[model samples]
Target chain A: MSEDKLLEVKNLRISFPTTRDRIEVVKGISFDLGREKLGIVGESGSGKSLTGRSILKLIRAPGQVTADKLSFKNIDLLAQNEKQMRNIRGTKISMIMQDPKFSLNPVMTIGAQISESLNAHNKLSKSEVNQRVIDMLNDVKINDPERVVKLYPHEVSGGMGQRIMIAMMLIPQPDLLIADEPTSSLDVSVQAQVLNVIDDLISKKGMGLILISHDLVLTSRYCDRILVMKSGEIVEECKASELANAKHPYTRGLLAAIPSLNETRDELPTLNRLQKEPI
Target chain B: MNAIELNELDIFYGDTQITDNISFDIKQGESFALVGESGSGKSTILKAIMGLAPKWNGSIKVNNVARSHGIDYDFAAQCQMVFQDPYGSLHPRKTVDATLSEPLTIHRISDQNERIEQVMQSVGLDLSFRFRYPHQLSGGQRQRVVIARALILEPKILLLDEPTSALDVSVQAEILNLFKKLRKERGLTYLMVTHNLPVVSFLCDRLAVIKAGKLVEVTGVEQLRQGNFKHAYTQELYAASGGVIS
Candidate 1:
């Protein structure tokens, strides 16, 4: 582990127990992150989401998570008990899931949820907590936060629901945020706006961010560095700007798959599964 | 006659209006797109045309035949829809062969085997994938199966609702190429609803931009190609989609 590394995960492995067989998803993966934004790119079932969830001990029974070294801001995450993990889950490190409908409690008011997160971690007065919730909502660019606070989860649209989710996650003022396909559910136009909101907050707060997505172009544009994962291991790691000229075949395949605005080919090149030879 | 026409269309879910005074027409064999953000009522227009949202005040004439708010067998035989998510649209318990043949069975079309095989090949799906379940196939394969199902009826007008948004980039490219080839071979009319401006430029001949349930502008693909979006809302949408003004 280095001095500037905010998160240092080494040789992490995760597996699930089935009725007749044990399936391993994450296989001895290692990665080190600084205070800047890092993105993990992989297709679904590639163990990308599991890796993010394992960081916060969100992998429950029937699924086992193990690592040689897992540390966050000089704290050993693996050694922490359930009590310590709870205190750290929302207060120090937080995650925003893909779908708001599933991530948010459908019955709870937006304000009540944010306040509940605050109450679990902070010892502030009710007024202080309310004011902080309002401030956080405003920070995420929610106009009329007061009115929005009363709305239930189902009442808000997808984009607004994502914004509210962000506000609730940030209200605790966590040092690290793990977002798993946060903008995939959003419309293309709204995707940029919501990402801009997250990007703005990450810069303002100087928090370490981990963005997990399958979009190669989007990851290149939004992240500082990109990690291309295949079969639970990193195939290539490069600076975001350097991705257009990536070296690895897997990364190249991913980039070539994106349909360019100035497309000339009758058919875009698709990656042959046989070509993915044990990277 | 235009392939599709809508004049003075107004849609309501109960008493609340969703889309207002919308009008557009698509020429025969032309790929037309409707672009808008979520909650901007893009899909509502498609639903209204498909007669899913029955509560509406307008005329939806497809292939010169006026459509009422109900299931029309003639319309089903002429037009069909391909949904966005292959996983959700496809039946988990049903095999790929069953999914493709179901529509033909419903329409009571003869020569089911030949029609299914032809459509399966047209969408570039191999014959081996016909018997596999949706869970056994990849995302790209599932989407291809969905496209094959849509084309099994040999519908002249295809209504695609964000078909590629649910797929991976590489998979999306493959699907896009399939769409291009299918359109070329069949001379099909496409009324695609997508928020992706790049996709519209890649596939559509003309586009209708909607905002807050109103038709803002109807522009040619050439304008989009030259980055010449006239309306402010269209330009804003183009900008938001990562298209920089040069």
Candidate 2:
């Protein structure tokens, strides 16, 4: 691993055991991350989420993850035991899921939940923890952190819930953040707000980010580098600025398929699956 | 005559008003859209038109005939609705063929087998999928089935409530294209509710922007393309979508 490389993955494969056969959803994908934004763009069932989850070893049994080299900061991730993995999960690399409705604990206060993330890794005093929770909430741009901290998860709106989720994930100041479709559930304006907050925090902390989303344009806009994934493989990799000129037919097809603000096409050109060649 | 008209519509759910005095019209064979954020009462407008929101106070006319506050088989034959969440809209246990045939049976239309086959083909679903249950089909395929069920009755108008929001972008494009082709071939009137602004530019002629149970702005799609919105909220929404015109 290079000195600047935060994480490195090679020949990563994730599989699930079914009744009759074993299905490999993520088949031999490889990538490296520095303190920069990397995006994995794919549609449903393209194994983008599985790859993100496999990084933290979040996938449970009946499912298996294998890799030739899975190292974070030169430490072997695949070699870590379960108890050891727990310390690395949130403190070193945290993940934010798609929906805040299901991710946040319904019964706990927002302050308590944020506090829990910090208290799990560090032994902080009561006042320090409370002040830190409020500060984190404010960092995510939540209004009136004092009042919001006392409210339950159900009381906050979807956007606020998502920001709260971000606050919880980032309070530990992880080296890498894996946000899997973080803003998909939010409205457009709120989506922009949430992404901006995340972007700001990542830059301020100088952390690596893996943004997993099905939206091509969104990924290109937010990430420094974009990886177009299809059927568990990286079909193309390029700078985000060069996504419009992506060489792969699949990438070109996806780029053309989205309706732009000034849409003039009589019909969007659908992706031709028969033309998809292995990369 | 207008294909659909709503005059001074006010919808309520047990004394809590969901939509204010909203009114709009869709001419014959016109494509119209209602766009807003979630819970802004865009979907409620579709529901009121479909008679699912029974507490509406106002007139709803389909093809110049006023609708009653109950299920009307005649109205059902002329107008049908395709809901959001294709996964939940279809019956989990029913095969695609069975789902398509039920609408025909409800309308007492004969020659059910032929109609089912034609509609399935029209929506671009393969014949092999006709026997598959909802779980057996993909999201796009299931949506195609839902659209097929809505079209099997030969309705002149369709109420699409966020039809493509649940699918992936490529799948969304395919479905949107399918909708365009269907509307052109059948000369259908559409009242689509969505929060996606670009979709309106691609698929509709005119759009009504709603906010907090009130009508914000009703403008032509050309204005939307130009980013020329009259209301401040509409401009806010346009900006929220990145305000890109190219």
Candidate 3:
């Protein structure tokens, strides 16, 4: 294994039990990640989010995650206990969920929540924590952080709420970020701003990013490499720049489905859902 | 003839005015779009037209008939709406057959069986899905069912609120194509509210950019494709949607 590799997964599989049998959601898949942005793009039940969650051992009971080898910085992730996993989570490999409105604690003030994350991993004075929280908020481009820190989640707009979530995730200064549809809930204009902030921070801190989204064009724009999953397996993997010329039929169909801004086609091409979207 | 017209429409909610001096006209069979952020009162305009938001002061005319300040059954049959979230819009307990039949039964339309079957076929759902509940359907299927419900009334106009935003890219493509086919076949006028510029470019002829309940810019899809917006906000929104004009 190369020293540059931040994460290494070799034939990882995740399954959940049903009444009849266990259904494997994430079939055996393998990949490696350095301190670079990697995008996992797929549909709703494609198991992309499950793959990301399994890395941090976020999958609960009746759900089984197994792998030939899964390591982060040469640390055996599969062997980590719940307590050890708790320490790894939010500090070493933090995750930012899809909706900021649901992820955030509504009763707690923004500053308190972010500060709580910071305090969990590190020991700092209250004044220093406040200063750090304000700085992190500013890093996410929140104007007048002092006032925002005092306000609750409901008081902030959707864009602001998402930025707060980003700030909280980054405050721990994790080695990697698993952003699952981070900007999906925000408006188009706000989406760009939020992604730009994440990009800026990732570059500055030299952290690995695993962006899980259903948007092909968007994931390509941010990631160095792209992995396209269908159902439980990875159908295609290629460089972000080569996505338009993807080899897999599913990828080609997805690329063709998105209506362009200057769409001239009378009918947008659609994948046959009944035939499993391969062709 | 104008299919729908809104003149100086001002909507209020318990002393709080939402939209101010909003006015537009949709020609017969023309698909129009209202594009903006979440709180811009885009959906509220549709609600006001559907009589969901009653506290409004404006002239709302459909097919040259001025709208009164109450429930209009004739208007209901004339203009139907498709909501944003397919998951929430559908009742979990109700089967597709029950859901589709309710509107027809309420309007006292005869030939119920044929109408229901034909509407389901139009939306591309086969007969097997009629008896199935919403939980058994995918997001795309549920959206199609919603569209089927809207079309079962045989309304002249459709008020679509981000109809495909919640579905997958491929499913969205299918739905957009379905909308295109339906409009061409039925000559239906659509008033769609969406923030996705590319979708607006595909399905709508003209679009109005709304910001904080105010109409900032009204431009054709041609101009939007060419990135020829006069307003700064429209340009910003276009840029944000990742303008891939290829």
Best by lDDT: 3
Candidate 3 regions exceeding 4 Å error are A275-279, B244-246
- Estimated TM-score per prediction? 0.95, 0.96, 0.97
**DockQ winner between candidates 1 and 3:** 3
Complex DockQ per candidate = 0.51, 0.57, 0.65
**Model 3 Cα lDDT, one tens digit per residue, B38-110:** 9999999999988888999889998999988778889889999999999999999999999999999999998
- Candidate 1 achieves a global lDDT of 0.88
Q: Which sections of candidate 1 miss by over 4 Å?
A: A18-21, A273-279
Ranking by TM-score: 3, 2, 1
- Better model by lDDT, 1 or 3? 3
Model 3 Cα RMSD, Å?
A: 2.0
Error of 3 at B189 (Å): 0.5
- Per residue, candidate 1 scores C-alpha lDDT tens digits across B1-246 of 799999999999999999989999999999999998887788998888888999989799998889989777778878889898998999999998899889888888889888888887778777777788999888888888888888888889999999999887777878887898899999999999998887887888889999999999999887886678779988888777767766
Error of 2 at A219 (Å): 1.1
lDDT of 1 by residue, A1-279 (tens): 377788999999999988878888999899988889999998877899999999999899889999999999889999999999999998999999999988899889999998999999889998998899899999988889999889999888899899888988888899999999999999877788889999999999989899999988888889999989888888889999999889999889888877655444556777764211133
Clashing pairs in 3: none
In candidate 3, position A93 carries an lDDT of 98
List where candidate 2 sits over 4 angstroms from the true fold: A273-279, B244-246
- lDDT per model, in order? 0.88, 0.92, 0.93
Residue-level error in angstroms, candidate 1, position B240: 1.3
Best of the two (2, 3) by DockQ: 3
